[model samples]
Target: MSLVKAGQLDYLNELFSRYSKRIYNYFLKSTLERAESDDLTQELFIRVMKYRNSYKEGHSVQFWIFQIARNMIKDHFRKMKIHKDQFNLVEVIPEREDVGDDELFEREKKLHRAMKELSDEKRELLVLSKFQGMKYEQIAKMRDTTVSNIKVQVHRTIKELKEAYFQLEEV
Candidate 1:
């Protein structure tokens, strides 16, 4: 890791190469805007570099990176308050013409809307676990919470999502 401190460009590039897609997807799922997600992803890496010295050598790099990504997302929302904006939900979700299964697409859209109705904490956990494919232990470690707590939260959040989803369906 000394290579990172010595301003080794290749080391930083390697780190970015390994994690960029994960980081971008994390932000993308939250922001739902390609350009904003890209910008936040770049900023997350920059923040990672700025705080590199603080990272313990034995720690999981993925968790550390995700923790940073989580904070960056929170700060982004706090600064812009974009969630309050009025917009067409259908338009906000980008169309994927490659998804030929109409039923699957509609289900996904309903799920997304259900996800959006959840509280921020619930939504973050859902995005990290479901969209980012993070295990509960990994999420707990990153969030500095217990695995059981994370599991419970995830369970409750899923229940909440189901209720909201059905309510929307009935309308």
Candidate 2:
């Protein structure tokens, strides 16, 4: 039992090291602030460590970690009254280079516009799948849905993104 506990701790540490950057970026995208995202990411790993004993064997670790992140995001939004804070580009916009500022700004504007058009669930799924590189099975487990549902949602989201891109091109 002691050996098992030791192994679990090692695994948890490994998981934290592997996924912290991705988790930080995910939170950064959702919150649009680097400092807040960093704090939340640290809080996430702390929670994982606190609850390590309760993690079931043979379950998907990625899903478990993502579920925790999802809950944290929901709590943050709830506490902050998300609707009151209009999507602010200044929070996430990068510094512009002299040569490509116009092109980059236009592209970022279009991407943000497209992301805003997606439903919250679709946006979250896309972030997890595309940004984090999580598999459909892991996302399904994290979201408490079936893998098939996740696949369908991803397909629809990709189609929507493509449509949005084309619309931007026409503008």
lDDT of 2 by residue, 103-166 (tens): 8787776776776566655666788898678888887877789999999999999899879877
Q: Which segments of model 1 are wrong by more than 4 Å? A: 1-3, 33-35, 80-95, 98-100
Model 1: colliding residue pairs: none
Residue 166 alpha-carbon offset, candidate 1, angstroms: 2.4
Whole-model alpha-carbon lDDT for candidate 2: 0.73
| lDDT minimum window of 10 residues, candidate 2 | 86-95
Please, what are the lDDT tens digits per residue for candidate 1 over residues 40-146?
A: 99898898789888777777788888888888878876754665574222323447675567887888778778877876667778889988889998988878899
Residue 39 alpha-carbon offset, candidate 2, angstroms: 2.4
